[model samples]
Target: MFLLYITALIIVIFLLETVVIDLFIVRGVKPDFILIITVYSGLFLNKTTAETIGFAFGLIQDALSFKQMGINSLSKFLIGYSIGSLRENILSENVIVQCLFTFIASCMNGIIYILILKGLFYSEIEVLDFFKDLLIQSLYNTFLAPIIFFMLNKVHFNNVREFRGRKEEARTD
Candidate 1:
């Protein structure tokens, strides 16, 4: 049941990010819902689970996109793994911090992805254009991250019992 809910959430976020928001509302800037989900999942979920979600979502994205396989998967895997490791160390439950991390991670992911693509394909994209798009997309993702995070947070809670359980744990510890 948990897996089903997460899968459905991923599908909805993917569609909303790529189809509804990117295609219709903001044609120029494409928000990275995958990155947001990966970061959110990593922050709240266990390492293996977070990485798995990231890998699965990345695979879905790669299958949907025309680009080569494994690129998205690898990037997302790294992002999820790294952030999950950080979460294990930090004890933060703040929404603002999560959004900030998502924003920074999205920016880093975009830059790293661009570099990886260039290295792999030897394609020389314009530097100015890359920065321009990166900035715009990062801002866009930052703006959208809170909404996605809130929705995913609810999924994580699952029910009032789960929420209460977490609150109890936090208070106890």
Candidate 2:
């Protein structure tokens, strides 16, 4: 099943994330490959599938980091839903569209993470520094999105929706 492949990807990426973080750190941040895949799922897959992809990626991150549970999952789930819902209204295949949404989603992910930390744990994070980090990571994610998206195009899950789609013209006959 396609889901099996996705699971494999999640595991491999998780490993790479942990193993190569220090080697790939730029300005103390590595490219958010998980976020890139989440964004891609939203752009190219059905809504429920997108949400699942996002939730899975985030849950893995949360579990590995040992932070507050569900924080990452909640953020990524919302991002996936928001982006996936827009697939019908926007040009999902356009590189520009992909880059723009990835940037927005990345910023939103940071905001959600920051807000949860600040509100739940009373963590002190300066707004300026948070914004700087958010911008850098958002741009980092955005920069890598198109390249990754292109590779994922080979999979093209849009045509492989899990649920049945709208009825064909035969229904009108």
Candidate 3:
């Protein structure tokens, strides 16, 4: 049941980010819902679940995009795993923490993609354009992170164990 809910949510977000979000783009900037979900899941979910969702959604995103394949999956999967690993160290209910995570994740995502493009595909790249887009996208995502987290908080994910950001004998499941 949890998987079904998450899958459906990701599908809806994927559609929104790909199609509907085009209308809201401001200066070639838009929020990355996939990245937000990846981070949110990492904070509130189990390690394996967070990484699984991140990689799967990234793959779906890659399959549909025109850019080099595997880039999204690799970056997002790493972000998910890294964030999940830090749950214990960064336990908090603060919005700033979420924004910080979003900012870092967004930057990391862009940097990884650019590296892959340059190293693997050997694509011609404009340095200024890359930094501009990366900054805008990271800011856009960072600003929206809190709102997304708040909304997702309203949705009860009953079937998964939510790590309390620390080790405890009590089980969430």
Candidate 4:
């Protein structure tokens, strides 16, 4: 059931990213829905589940992207694992924290993607332009974080504790 939900979410987000999201593009930089989802999964879900979702979504994005493959997958996997590991220590419910996480995650994703491309393909990325784009993308993702967080909060998958409690109750009974 969780897998099904994730699949549906990836499809919907992909469609929206390709179609509707472009309409709101500012300065040729668009909000990364996949990155946002990956971060959200990490912040809200268990580490294993978050990493799985991140890898799956990143693979899908890589397949659809014209850039080199596997970059997104690796970056998202790391982000998911890193952020999800903070679930116990961080105050994830705060809006500021969510935005900060999104910002940092977005920056990390951009840096990882660029570094991989540069190292593997000998791509010459201008430092200033790269930093400019990275900042823009991070801010854009941060701006959208709260809204996405609210929506994802309403999702049943976020209720992992309740599901576990029910299973435990059944086992005891």
Candidate 5:
């Protein structure tokens, strides 16, 4: 059931990503919704689970996306792992803090992605493209992060806990 929920969420995010806002229009950037999910999941789940989901989601994103293969996977995995580890120290359960982290992660992910792509594809990659995409995507994700975090937190944590308790009660019954 949890797997199904996550799958459904992934599908929704994927669809919204293409048709929703033209975040890239301002600076020509590419946003990774899966990456955001990985970060959020990592913050909530254990390390192994987080990394596994991160890698899995990254692979899914890479497979669906048109960008260079493996980039999404690597970036998402790293972001998820780092964020999950950071959560131990930060106690960032607040919505505002979560949003801030998401924004920062999104921005950093964008920059790192562009850098990796440029490094792999071209020796002399243009800086303007990197900066433009990074800025636009960061801003866009920042705006969207709060809403996403709210929704996900409700579904993944609240509903999940409810489901678990219900399941346990059913077992005892």
Candidate 6:
């Protein structure tokens, strides 16, 4: 049931990102909804689950966009794994922490993608322009993270263990 929900949600986000999000673009930059979803999965789901979703959705996005295959997949896979690993040490419930994680993940994804593109294809993308776009996209993703987090929280997944169990345990002391 949880897997079904996540798969459906990813499809919906992918559709929205490819077909709808461009309408709301600002300064020629649009929020990456799929990226946000990957971050959310990393923060809330198990590492393996999150990385799997990242790779799958990244492939879907690549297919839809006609870009170099596997670039987005590799970037998102790393982002999901890296951020998901931090779940053991950080307070995932904090909005500020969520925002920061999204920002950092977005920046890392951009850097990794650019590096791969440059290294593999020798694409002559201007460094400053890429940085400018990266900054804008990071800020845009950060702004959307809180809202995405709130919405995701409402959709309970049985596979994920609630942190409330720890609080309940402490209360008995």
TM-score, every prediction = 0.84, 0.86, 0.88, 0.87, 0.76, 0.89
Candidate achieving the largest lDDT: 4
Clashes of each: 0, 0, 0, 0, 0, 0
Q: Give me the displacement of residue 157 in model 1, in angstroms.
A: 2.1
Question: How many pairs in model 6 have backbone atoms within 3 A of each other, for residues 3 or more apart or on separate chains, i.e. clashes?
Answer: 0
Tens-digit lDDT track of model 6 for 139-164: 99999999987877777533334545
- The CA lDDT at 87 in model 1 is 80
Q: What residue runs in model 6 are displaced by over 4 Å at the alpha carbon? A: 157-161, 166-173
Which of 2 and 4 is the better model by lDDT? 4
Candidate 2 weakest lDDT stretch, 10 residues: 161-170
- C-alpha lDDT values of all predictions: 0.77, 0.81, 0.82, 0.84, 0.71, 0.83
* Of candidates 6 and 5, the better by TM-score: 6
Give lDDT tens digits, candidate 3, residues 79-160.
9999989876775357888999989999999999999999988889996799898999899898888887777766743322
Q: Indicate the TM-score of model 4.
A: 0.87
What's the true lDDT of residue 119 in model 5?
A: 80
Alpha-carbon deviation at 11 in model 3, angstroms: 0.5
Name the regions of candidate 3 deviating beyond 4 angstroms.
157-173
The predicted structure with the larger TM-score, 4 or 6, is: 6
Name the runs in model 1 displaced over 4 angstroms.
Answer: 21-27, 158-173
* Residue-wise C-alpha lDDT for candidate 4, range 146-171, written one tens digit per residue: 99878777665448557457546876
Could you tell me which 10 consecutive residues in candidate 4 have the lowest summed lDDT?
155-164
Order the numbered candidates by lDDT, best leading: 4, 6, 3, 2, 1, 5
Query: Which tens-of-lDDT digit does each residue in 1-173 have in candidate 5?
Result: 65577779888777877677574345556666776677677666566666777778777778876765787778878888888787655645566777778777887777767778778866465788767667777777767666776677676776557646755687699
